[model samples]
Target: MSDFNSKHEKVAAKLRNEITGTEYEPGDQLPSEKRLCDYFKVSRVTVRHALQTLENERLIYRKQGLGAFVADTTLNSGLVQLTDFSEDMKKAGLKSSSGLISLDKVEPIKEVNEILQLRPDMKLIRIDRIRFANGNPVAFDITWLPPGYGQLLFDEDLTTQTIYDVLEDKYEIPIQGGSYRITAKNADDYIAKHLGIAPESAVLEIDRCSRTTGNKKVYFQKRYYNPSHVSYVLELSRNDNESMSSKDGLPLKEFSPSFAK
Candidate 1:
């Protein structure tokens, strides 16, 4: 590589480490470009290149005429992977936790009942929680599970453990796959309260149905994510014959047809 390229990359590497580490937290503004140039003994162009690299990685975002600020470093998930909240936070180098809102056995809504293939009289275990990343509220989740799987959670601590972990590890019920429907919605009063955002703020909503062996549904959950703290990346290939699939075990056939939208 040329000396110029090497210098810019070195600058970017240093900044990347600092942003990912405790040195710089989310929303922290980076040093001015002029200051960075002076400190690194590089030209303005080199510093700009470094900043551009970090921006492309989603580690930082630059404001026109203002400066670059660290991006929220939580819950950035690649759509191809099937990971829980804890796993996503870990991958982003953020601490993950949950605050249990309510856990109860109740009659589920009609939609949920149908999704779980339960009779009208059957009650489901409902778990409501606010998920946190580095102690910041990131998502409000409402999960409904069938009686058998739901009973397992009563003994486990929801604050420190995810339902996915509990079912897969303790009960040995592997979550084989899931179907997801993603959308954007304005936060209602209840969702806003739990997510600690303004009422009517935009949020990313995900309706997910996870299944175990033999395609038996395990849980149906609605997750409302704080947009500022979460982002999703979808990777696609150009080959027409290539089958598109989600690493998160989501079946593409479950996705809504283009004309249906």
Candidate 2:
């Protein structure tokens, strides 16, 4: 029932199934390009693309001079702390900078109301900027602020400084807990141009809503990151004395067993 337009996707899906079903186990060599072409009755380009799709998913890996092989399945990062963007870059030894794209006071939109608990007529200061690491555009951030905070953006140079720093130093906004959701998306024309990637290229989009001790939502931000450049990592440990593996064979190492002695 699949259509012609989804030919590549269909092939990719089938290839993924084969990988999951152990048609090719970890460390097992994949068939050569010509062999894959013959088996799938597809062109070399199609086969290569299928493999590339798997590579991106970390389901398979290519070894130099050796054929592609199934990757050792492992759990990715877990959700934990809400780290500051500028601090993360600094720790990575990357020269981080921000360029102000726009700053305006606008009436809170419907989505803003839900995220920030804004009143019906409340206004907000919205800032859009490009965050650079090592002078290369890595993220496009649009940050929203509740009213009065608009003053902070005007007196401080948000372009060359960390927003978190400005918030703490000038506005006295306490660094409190926040929540974030991350997912993969394709870049649109605007994002593509800004990030220097082709339209529809893969991107990791993070939606974050931060609040203070009083639960006052001060910042709601949308960050679009280039997956090829940066990866988000979270460290966790296991606490339960259960067996190491689950019914699905996933490890039970969810929390660290020991604290600092």
User: For residues 119-211, could you state the per-residue lDDT of candidate 1 as single tens digits?
Assistant: 877899999999988898989999999998899999789999899878765655656568788999999999999999999999999999998
> lDDT for each of the candidates?
0.80, 0.71
Clashes of each: 3, 6
The most accurate candidate by TM-score is 1
Worst 10 residues of 2 by lDDT: 252-261
The candidate scoring highest on lDDT is 1
TM-scores for every candidate against the unseen true structure: 0.62, 0.60
Each prediction's Cα RMSD?
Answer: 17.8, 21.1
lDDT of 2 at 200: 98
